[model samples]
Target: MSASETNSFRAGRIVQLLFGIAVAAAFMLPIVWLVAGSFRPGSEIFTSLDPLSIGTFIPPRPTLANFGSALGGAFRTGLINSIVVAACTVVVGLLVCAAAAFALSAMQWRGREVVFAIIVFSFLIPEEVVALPLSAIFAQGGLQNTYTALIVPFVGNGIVIFLMRQFFLAIPRSLIEAAQVDGAGWLRIFLQIFLPLSRPALIAAGVILFNAQWQAYLWPLLVTTRADMLLAPITLGLMVGEHTSDYGQIFAASTILSFIPAVVLLGFQRFFTDSVAMSGVKE
Candidate 1:
């Protein structure tokens, strides 16, 4: 290669590397601040934003005080409730949405497209718009403040159904046909064939559902008024109105809440990427 071309290529490579680093740092800064703030006391969190200072990037003297306060009493109960809600949602969504998606993808039925359109259209509706009616329904049914109130509303998830349907649509029809030729029914085919090949999409959908339920604020706040029924976001929010705000405990609670989603994504990050990418590649 000529020197000019070589120099140009080298410059582009350097530029790309710098841009990648910048993007990564942009995404990581909030998390870094969260961890740093969690370690620092309430005093350090309100540190001046002057450029000359080390800023809030690191704790001057890190302590476990924040974690101690966050992991007990109402906070602990909140965390457990959040976990239970998310777990049940993922499991129910997995089985139900998988079945719904399977029929939408692999079956030949009348009005399939029309049904699918209606289901997918629900995804566009804002959750806040439905929160009030849902609260009333739960209250009327005597489900309010019960785990059923938490689990039932989120179980019929449109996004999960749409995502799984899209993924299933990409599966080779020949596979389903062969299974049918071998005298396998739809249930047998789904259980013994399609589901086994859909690990990535299933994991990805679970991660999405789990994250949604965990980060939820308004819905939990609306339907569940009991203190013990609170989730992470609601718990953190109530801390603000405490007799006195402890930013340290607040930050710690936020950090723990944040960590669950991060760990969930990290746990299934590979599958999540593959599921999204493959869903777009239809045969």
Candidate 2:
């Protein structure tokens, strides 16, 4: 290529990199503001909002008091409750989704394509549409205010099943055939071979499951009226009373809530990306 063309290419690459960084910063700005506000007094949080300035994004006199308050009382219980619910859901959800994905992708049963299509269709349906009916059903079964109620609904996650199924479809069929030839049963093959080889996909699915349960607010609000069973988001909701609110504590809890999931996703980001890429490419 000519020197002019090479220079143009380098310039284009630099522009693209800068644009990407700008976009990422734009997205992160709110989170940064939230963290900043959390360290300031509740009254001072919105004080700089009249005309935005550096003070808007930076707490001049920062304190740990908000975090201290956030980590105590009902909010503390809510954090623990959310953690327990999300952890339990991830464990149960992975097994259920993996099995469903395996059956759909590996087995050549009747109506396999139809079943897969249905699963795809199910994920497309908004949770809000089903939340009311699910609440009624759970109420009838006397499962409200129980951890089982929270964990059970999330175990059969359609998106996780779809993700796992896509990953499973990318696996070589020769492995399944060879295992069968060696007199290995389907369960044995799945446990010993497929599960062991699908680490990236499993991590991706686990992350998805954990995030789903972690961010769950509407459903938890509808089902559990008890303060003890309050999830983090619901607890955050309660902090905003009609008469007054505590912005500092709110932001602190929000930061902690966002931080946990961000850490989880970042920690397994490579595996998540690999799983997504592999699922996209099929032989």
Candidate 3:
């Protein structure tokens, strides 16, 4: 290539790179504001909003008092409760989803496609539509304000099952047949082969389940009434009052709440993307 042409290409590439960085920073501004606001005093949070400046993104006198308050009392309990609930959901939900996916994809059974179609349709239905009825049923069953109410209702996630099934479908049938011919039972094959090979899909499914439970507000509100049983999101809501609000603590708590799932998603994003892409590729 000519020198001028090479220079032009480099200039174009630099422009694209600069544009991408600018876009990323724009998207990150809110998160940056949230994190910065967390360290500011409650009275000072909105003081600098008249004219946008570096002060808006940077707290002049930062303090840990908000975090101290946020991590204490009921909010702390809520955070722990959220972690426990989300973790339990991920573990149990993954098992149920993987097994259901294996059955639908590996085992040749009558009405398999129909069952999967039904499962696909099920997740599409908004949870808000079913929350009231489920809440009533749980109330009747005496499961209100309990971890069982939180965990069990979400154990069989259809989206996770669908994602796993798609990934499972991409697995070669020959592998399953070979395992069967080697005298491996269906259970053994699933345990040893499919599960091991589908780590990326499993991570993706677990992230989805964890995020769902972590951010759950409406269902928890419907099922749980006790202060101690509240999840982080619900506790955050309670932190606000009609008369007064603790903006600093709220920002700190929000930062913590957002950080956990963001870290999980970032850590597993490569695997998640790969799983989604491969799951779309059918034999």
- The C-alpha TM-scores of every prediction are 0.93, 0.94, 0.95
Q: What's the CA RMSD for each of the models?
A: 1.9, 1.6, 1.6
- The 0-to-1 C-alpha lDDT of every candidate, in the order given, reads 0.87, 0.91, 0.93
Clashes of each: 0, 0, 0
For model 3, the run of ten residues with the poorest summed lDDT: 47-56
lDDT of candidate 1 at residue 163, scale 0 to 100: 89
TM-score of 1: 0.93
Q: Candidate 3 residues 16-50, lDDT tens each?
A: 99999999999999999999999999999988855
Q: Which ten residues in a row have the lowest lDDT in candidate 1?
A: 47-56
The per-residue C-alpha lDDT of model 2 at residue 225 equals 92
lDDT (Cα, 0-100) at 122 in candidate 2: 91
Off by over 4 Å in 1: 49-52, 280-283
Query: How well does model 1 score by local distance difference test?
Result: 0.87
User: What does candidate 2's lDDT look like per residue over 1-110, in tens digits?
Assistant: 99999999999999999999999988988888998989999999877755357887877899999999999869899999999999999888998899999999999999
